[model samples]
Target: MHSNVVGGSDRIGEIIEVRGADGTPPYRVRYPDGHESLMFPGPDCVIEQGSATAAAGRR
Candidate 1:
């Protein structure tokens, strides 16, 4: 997820659990720093599909 703060970098996290019906919003995510939170994504968030490797920028 993109940081709301200016000059802040984006965050990377794994979707450990899904709270939304039919895989919608409100995901349970675990970050690399070992923190987890329930997230309802905003417009800055983007969901990418493909290989396990990560990449940035919009589609």
Candidate 2:
């Protein structure tokens, strides 16, 4: 996810839960650091599908 603050570090995570319907806010994501957060992504945030190779590497 993109940081709301200028020059802040951005993060990438796996979406573990969605609280509402499609295109809804307040998603639960588990980061690589093993931490999870409920987030409402802002304009700077983006979501991309993970590739098969990437997924395999995680396992």
Among the numbered candidates, top TM-score falls to 1
Per-residue lDDT value at 4 in model 2: 79
lDDT of 1 at 22: 96
Candidate 2 Cα errors over 4 Å, as ranges: 4-7, 51-59
Cα lDDT of candidate 2 equals 0.83
Cα error, residue 30 of model 2, in Å, equals: 0.6
Scored against the true structure, residue 5 in model 1 reaches a CA lDDT of: 96
Per-model lDDT? 0.78, 0.83
Candidate 1, poorest ten consecutive residues by summed lDDT: 50-59
TM-score of 2: 0.67
lDDT of residue 33 for candidate 2: 91
